[model samples]
Target: MPLKSTLAVPITDDPSLPVVTFRFWLISFFFTALGATVQQYYFFRSSSGTYSIFFVNLVSFSLGKAMARTLSERKFTLLGQTFSLNPGPFNIKEHALIGIAVSTGAGSAYAIDILSATDLFLGYRINALGSILLIITTQCCGYGMAGLLRRYLVYPAEMVWWSNLVQVVFYNTMHNTQDFQSIRLIRGWSRMKFFWIVTVTVFLYQFIPQWLAPILVYFDWLCWIRPFDMNFWAFFSSISGGGILSLSFDWTSIGGATMYLPLSAQLCSFAGVIVNYWIILPIMWMNNYMGVKAIGKPLTTKLFYEETGLPFNIKPFLNQDYSVNETLYEQGPPANMAPMYALGFMTSFMGLAACCTHVGFFHGREIWRNWKQAVGSDQEDIHTRMMRVYPEVPQLWYAGFYLVMAVLAAVACEFYVDLRYLLPGKPIANMTFKCYGYMAMSQCNLLLSDLKLGHYMKIPPRSMFVGQIWGTVVGCFFNYLTMILIINSQRDALDGTKPDANGLWTGQRVQTFWGSGLIYGALGPARMFALDGKYWFVYYGFLIGFLGPIVLWALSKKFPQYRWWSKLNVAIFAGGLHNFPNGYAMGILVSLITALVFQWFLFRYHKAWWTRYTFILSAALDAGAAFTGLIIFLFLGGGLSPKLAVNVPSWWGNYYTPEGDNGPYLAVDRCGAANNAWTSGAEL
Candidate 1:
C-alpha cells in the first residue's frame, strides 16, 4: 500500500484461535438482527440515521467478553462437528467476523427501495414469497463477481480500499487496548469508556430535536425574521425555500461520514449545492424556465402538475390497466418536477458518467497492472503472508451460490414481468431488472471492501464467506419485514395522506425512487428528454460530467505545481450534490460544517485526539441518534400505543400544521404565504 505508515497493523496470527464457535454464531446473529432492525427502520425517515459498525464493534465486544466469562465452555457435537458454548476468549478473529456479519446485514437492501416505490406510489404489491426471493437474490448476486475479482481487488497489497483501514484500526484498538495509552481529552478514560459516555449523552439529548421542540432540527432563524412575507419565505425559509444559513443541530441531520471523508470531497459537494440550489434554482424560478415557477417551489423533490401547481396525480396519466393512456398523456401537461429536482437528476447523470472517466483517468492503469500481477506474482506483504495460513474459500463455492441466487432472481423477475398489463406493474419489471443488474456490481464492490477488511484482520476466508452469507440471509428477511411494517403503519405519511409533524416520516427516499420509475418507466426518456422537451438540457449533464474530469486531468498534468487539482474529485462532488435534494435543506450547511470541524480542523490540529476518539465519536453519535429515534417512533409516534401516542402539548415548537394546509396558518414560522406566492404561467 502507498500509505505504508497507516498499514503498520499487526501481522502476527495464532491459527489455533477458533474462527467460528457457539458465541460467534450467537453474537453474529444478535448483531445482524439489531443492525438490520435499526437500519431498515430508519431507511424511510427524513433524517435516516445508520447503525454503523463502530457501534456494532463496541456492543459485540462487551457481549463476547460476557459470554466468555459467563457461559460454561462445555463442548457439544452437532451434525458431525464439535463446538463450545464459549470460545477461548473472544479473540480478534471472532470479533472481526461479528463486524463482518453486522456490516453485511445492516444495509437495507437496495431492492427494498424498488419495492417500496412500487407499493406506495404505483399502488402495487408483490406477494410475500416473491418479495423474499427478490431481496435475497439481489443481495447475493454480487458474491460471484466478488469471488472472481478477489485476486485483483483483495489479495493484492496495493489495492488498499482506504476506507477499510479505519475499521481495521478500530478492530485492533478495541481488542488490543493495552498497547495504546489513554489521552487527556477525556483524561485517563479509555476509548471504550469514552464511547459509551458520548453515546449515552447523545441518546438523552436527541429527544429535544427529534421529539420535543422539533423546531431545532432545522433552526431557521431567517424565517423567523419575516415569518409571513411570502417573498422572503421563498428566499430564506429552510423548509420551503433556499436553505442558506439554516443549520440543523441534530447529529442525524449532519451525517457521521463527515468525520472521515476528506475535506476536499465535502467542499466539492458544497460547491455543487451552492451552484445548483442557491444560484441556478432562483434564476430559473424567477425566469419561469420550463414553467418552474408553476411548480410552487424553486427547490423540492415533489412531483407537480404543470397546470395546477399541485401534486401530480399519476391516476390521470394511466389507463384503467395502469399502462400509459396515450390519449390522456397527449392531452394533459407533462409531469413537472421542481427545478432543483431536475438539477438533481442532472447531478446523478453527471455522477455516473464522471465516475467511469474519473476511475479510468486516475486508477485504470494501476488496476490493469494489478490484475496482471495478481495472476503471476509471488510477492506478499506481512498481512498477506500471515493470511496465507488460512485455507482460502474455494471459487466453486462462490460461483455455485451466485448461480443459485441469479436463477432465483431471474425466476422472480419473470414472474413479475408476466404480470405486465394484467396488473399496473410494468414498473416492477423495470425496477427488478435495474436492481439485479446494477446492484450486483454495487454489491461486488462492497463485498470486495469487506474482503479487504478480512484480509487486514487475517480472518479465515471460509469463515468470512460463511459469516457474509448468513448475515445477508438474515438481512433480507429483516429488511423486508421492516419495510412491510413501515409501509403498513406509516402508510399515511408514506403515501402523502398525512405527513409527519416532525419531518421524520417523509418517505422522500422512496418518493425519489418512484419519481425515477415515472421518468424511466411511465413517461419514458424519449418523451421526457426529447430535444424539445423540458429536460433536454439535463442530458448535457452527461457531457459536463464526462469532460469536466478530463479537463481537470489535463490541467493537473500541465500545472503540477497546483497539487490540489489532482486531488479534486468531480464524481464525489456530483454524488454529494445529487444527495442534497432529498428533503433536508439544512443538511447541506450542517454537514459541511461538520466535515470542516471533524475531518479538517481536528485532523490537522489535534492529531492525537483525532486518532484516538474520532471514529468512536462518530459511532456513538449514530448509535445514540438511531436508538433515540427508534424509541420515539415506537413509544411516542404510536408504534406501541396508538391512541395515547403523539399527545405532546402543542406549542410553537411542536405546532406542525403543514404550510398551505387548512388547520394552521403557520408551520412553526408562519411561512404559509410562501406556498401561494407563485402562479403557473397557464393560470397567470
Candidate 2:
C-alpha cells in the first residue's frame, strides 16, 4: 500500500509562527547534555537503552509552554537586530527545532567506540585534542553529505523514511489544539488524552520488567520446562540459544521503531531471522558442521579458541607497536566464532552489497531525474511549493563545509599514523579509519532523515542547518566527558576484573568494536579470510547480496501483476536478519507481531484510529519506558552513588546463578553441560 501524505504528515504550514526562538536553544542544549550523558552511560550495559527524540518532544513541550507563560516579551536589540525573549506562543516550529537538536545530540558519538576499545582492550588512550577533533570531523562530514544529497533522498515523496512519521504525528498531536473525533474502541479519548494516558500507564508498568522482576525481559519459559536438559535449553533459551517462540514483556525490547517501520519491511526482516536462527544455526550446531562442536554454543557474539572453550586471546598476537606478530599468530590456533556470529558477519556483507544494488534497481531513474532538475526548479508537491517562500541553503556552503571537515579528519587521523605499513596494525588508527570512512556514510543517512523531517515541518533550511550543527557539537563534548568518567570510575568492571552485580557495566558494545579492530587491524583480512581459512566461504556473501536484489528486480519486472514481489526488499531482509543474533531475537519477533497489529491490521480495518493514535501510542510508550529506565538506573542501578547498593530480592523469577560459560545477564538456560562438545561430551 502506498503511504498517504495527509494521514502521515501535515500538508499546511504557518509562516507567522516564530522559529529559532529562545525556547529552542535552551531546551535543545539542556536535553542534549542530559541525553548524551544518559546514552553514553547505557552504551556499556548489556540491555542498552536509547534516549529518543520522542522523550524530548514530550518534555520540551512543557518547558516551552512554561517559558511562554513566565518570560517577559520585552524586545531587545543585539548586533543591529531586534529579538524578544518570549515568542507570541509556543509554536510547532520551535518544538520541531528542539526535537531535531535533541535527536542529533542524543546519539552516542561514534568515536567513543574507538576511545573505549583502545583504552580498555589495548591499553592505549587517545589524547583529548585528537579525540575531540575525531568526533567533530566525523560527524560534520555527514552534514555536508546530507546537504549535497538532499535533492534525491529528502525531497522525493517516495523516500518516506517511515520512522520519522511517528515523530511528526506526536508533534501534531501535542501542538494542534483542535480536537479529533474520539474512537469508541479507545473509550472516546482524543489523541492528546490518549498520549498522556499511554505515557503514564507504561511509565508505571515499566518498573515491573526493568527492575522488580527482570526475568520478564526475556521470558524464555520453555527453558524452564527442562532446565537440566542441554539440548532443550539450546533450542529455546532466549539469552544464549536459538530463542524459538520466546516472549518479552520489556518495553525496551518490544517498543522501538518496530511500531513505526513499514510492516512489509518488518516481515522481510523476520524472514531473515527465521532462516538464520531457526534453520542455518540449528543445522550447523546439531550436525557439528565445519568443526562447530569445538565452538561450544550455537549462538554468541564472543569469539572463542578452537583448542579451548575460553575467549580468544588477542593480546599475545600483538607486537610492541600493536601490529600482528605474523610468525607467532600463524603458530597459534585460529580463533573461532559460533556459527550464528559467523553467519551474522556474512549478512552484514550481504546487506552492504545488497543496499547498493537495491537502491540502483528501485530508485535509479527517479534519482537521475532529480539530479538533472535544478535545485530551485524541482518542486513536486504543495509542501515543496510552500517551502519556496523560504530561501534554500546555498550549495557552496555544503561544499566548503565538506572540504574543511575532510582536512580536519585527515589531520586528526595523522596524529596516530605510524610511518610504517600503508595500513598500520595500530588498533586506534584502524578505528579512526573506520569511523571517518564508514561512519560518515551512516551519518549522511541520519542527517538526510532529519532533513526530511525539516521538509515535512516546513522549517527554514538555514535554521535546521544551524540547529544540527549546534546539537552535534554539544553532544560530542558531553559524550566524551561521560566516557571519561565511566572509564575512570568503573575501570575494573569494564576491563573484566570485577563483575557488575547488577549487570550494568559489561562493556559488550566496546568489546564488539574491539573485536573488529583485531580482525581488520592486527590480524589483516588476508589471514582471517584466507583461501584455506574456515571463513573463506564468508566472502561469497558479497556475491549473494549483489545477485539477490537483481533477481528480485527481474522477477518484479517479469510479474508486474504481483505487487508483493516489488515490496520484498532484500537489503532490509538481510539487515533485519543480522539484528536477531544477539539478545534481540525475541524482541524482533515481538516487534513483528506489534507491527502486524498496528501497521497492517488496524491500518486496513480501522483507518481513523490508526492514523490518529498509532504514532502517538508509539511515542508515548517510548517516552514512558525511557523515563522509567532512567529513574531505575539513577536510584536502584547505581547512577548517583556507588555505595547506595540497592538490589532486588533474589527469587525464582530474578535468580542468577553463574555456571560454566554462560555470558552475563540471567536466563533460565542453565545448561553447563552444553559447554562441552556434543560428540565426545568432553570440555574442548
Candidate 3:
C-alpha cells in the first residue's frame, strides 16, 4: 500500500494563534535549563544512564494552556496576514516546536565529550571557545547534509521513522477528533480514555523500583543463590562483561525502547547480541585464541594496550605543540591491538558498508524517482506541492549554509591545533579520513531520521534546516558546560577504574569515548589496523556489512513470506556489539519482551487499537518513568545518606553490599588489579 498524507488542514487548525510568545520561549528555556541540571546530576552517578525530557511535555502543555487564556488577543500585521499575540488558544504544534527547542537546547554533541575526555584524562589542553565552536559545526554539518538531500530524503512518504511516530500520533489525537468517532479501540475501549488510564497507572507504579526498592533494577537471583561462591555469582553479573542473561526489573530502562521498534527488529538485534557476545566472544576467550588471554576488558581499546604489557605512550608521538606528530607516528612502533579490541573495531567497517548497501537495496528507486520529479518540477510529492505556497528555498541557500558551518569548523580546528586530531572536518592526513568514516555512519542516519520527522509533522524544509542548524548551536553550549563540570568534579572516576567515596561517579562511557579519540585520533587506523598492522583482519567487517544486505534483499524478494529475514537490521549487526561498556544488554532483553507482547501480539490482534494506543502508551510509560527517576534523584540522596532509604528494609535484595564496588560477586570479564604490568608501554 502506498503511504498517503495531506497538509491542507493545519496541525491545530489555529495558525493565527500566537506561537512565538513569552510563555512558549520561557517554558522551553526552563526545560533546557532543567535538562542541563539533570545531565550534570546523571553524569556523576555510579550507574551509566542518561535522562530524557519525557516529563517536560506535561509541564509545558499545562503552562502553555494557562498562558493562552491569560495573554491578550492583540492583533498585529507581520506581512499581509494578521497575527494574534494571545493566539486564540495554545496548540499542539506550539507544544511540539517548544519541545524540539528544549531537546535541542539540552542535546548532546559528540565533540563535547570528545574534547572533555581528551582534556581531562589525556592531558590535552582545548580552548573553551574552540570546543564550543567545534560542537556547533559538527552538529550543523549533519543538518546541512540533511538539507542538501531533502528532495530525496524528506519528500518521500515511506520515510516514516518508527521512533517519531509517537509524536505524530499524539499531535493529531490532541487537536483533531476524527479518529475518535464512535470507534471502540483495543479492548473495546476509547483510546482517549485508555491513554489516561495507562498514563495514571504508569505514573503511580513507577515509584516502586526507582524510589523504594532500587535493587529490582538488577534482580540477579543467581547472586543470592550462591552468596558464598564468587564464581557462581559472577556468572550472572550485569554491569561488567559477564551479564550472561541477567534480568532487569526496571521497566523504564528495559522495555522503553521497544515501544517504538516492532518485534522482528528487536529480535534481530537480540540475536546479534546473543551470537556475538554470548556465543562467539566467550568461546574465543575460553580457548585463549587471538591473544584473548591478554585481553583486559570488553568494550575498551585502552585495556587492550594495558593487557598486552605495552600501553600507549603518547610522549613519543606528540609534537612540541602537543599535537600528534604525524611523521613520527607513521614510523613509530605500532601498538599491539588485543583481539578483543580488534573485534570491536571491526564493527565500524560493517556500519559503513551497511549505510551504502541498505539504502541501495530498499529506497534506491523511490529516491531516484523523487530526485527526477523534484528537478523536473512534475509530480512533486503531495507534501512538496503543499509547501509550494511558501517561497522555495534555493539549493544555493543550503550550499551557503554548509559553507558557514564548514568555515567555523575549520577555524575551531586551527585555533586548537593541538586537539585538531579530534576534528574530523579538518584536512589532517589520516585523522580526517578516519573521522569522516565515523561521520558518514552517523550523518546518513541523521539525514534519514530528520526527513522522517519533517514528513510526519509537515514542517517546511527551509524551516527544518534553520531549526536543526541553530538548534545544534543552542545544544552545544549546555552540553559543553555539563562536560566541564563532570570532568573537573570527578577526575579519577572519569575512567571508572577508581571508585569514589560515594560510589556515584563512574567514567565507563568516557573511557570508551576517550579510548576512541586516543586510537583513531592519536595513533591513526593505518598504524593500528591496516596491512602489516596488528588488526588487519578487522577490515573484513565491511565486506560482511555490504554482503549481508545484498543477500537479505535477494532472499526477501524471492520469498516474501520469509520477509522477516530481510528485516535483519544491518545497523544492529554493525554497531550493536560496540555499545556497552555500560552493559545495556539487560535493557535489550527487556525491549525484546515488550516488542513481542505489545507490538507483535496486540498490534496483530487488534489493528485500530494498536494504532491508537501504542504510541500513547509508550509516551505515558516514558513520561512516568522519567518523572519518578527525576523526583528520586532530586529528593532522595545517594551513597550512605540516601534520601528515603529508611522506607525499605535492609536485606540482601534491598541493599547490595559489595566486597568490591562493582560486580554481584566478581567482575564479569574476570579482570582484577592491573598492578602487575598495567603501564608497560610499547617495546619502543
Q: Output the number of the TM-score-best candidate.
A: 1
- The TM-score values for the models, in the order shown, are 0.92, 0.86, 0.78
Please provide, for model 3 over 212-313, each residue's C-alpha lDDT reduced to its tens digit, 9 standing for 90 to 100.
Answer: 554565555554454433333223444434456666666665645576576666776677666655666556555555554554443344533434545565
Off by over 4 Å in 1: 1-6, 180-185, 316-322, 368-372, 376-388, 416-425, 640-644, 657-666, 674-684
Displacement of residue 399 (Cα, Å) in model 3 is: 4.5
Report the Cα lDDT for candidate 2: 0.73
1-684, model 1: which lDDT tens digit per residue?
256523456767788988777888888887787778778887887676778788888888888888889999778898998877875788888999888888888888988988897788768787888888889999998999999998777877666777777777777876787653444347678667778888899999999888887677767777666665544555566666776677777788886878877788778878877665566655765677766666655665667887777887776676654567767777867677776788887888899899888888877787777666666678865677788788988899998998898788777766753335312224455666678788899889888989988888888999999988989999889888878877877888788776665556778778777777776767777766788977777888899889989999899889989888846888887876775466556667778878888888889999887887787788989988988987887777766457546755766766754341323333443444523542222232
Q: Give the whole-model CA lDDT for all candidates, comma-separated.
A: 0.76, 0.73, 0.57
Query: Which is the better candidate, 2 or 3, if ranked by TM-score?
Result: 2
lDDT tens readout by residue for model 2, 241-358: 6777777788877765776677888889888887776677667767776556665566655567766667777788777776777788779777766666667778888998999998
In the predicted model 1, the residue pairs found to clash are none
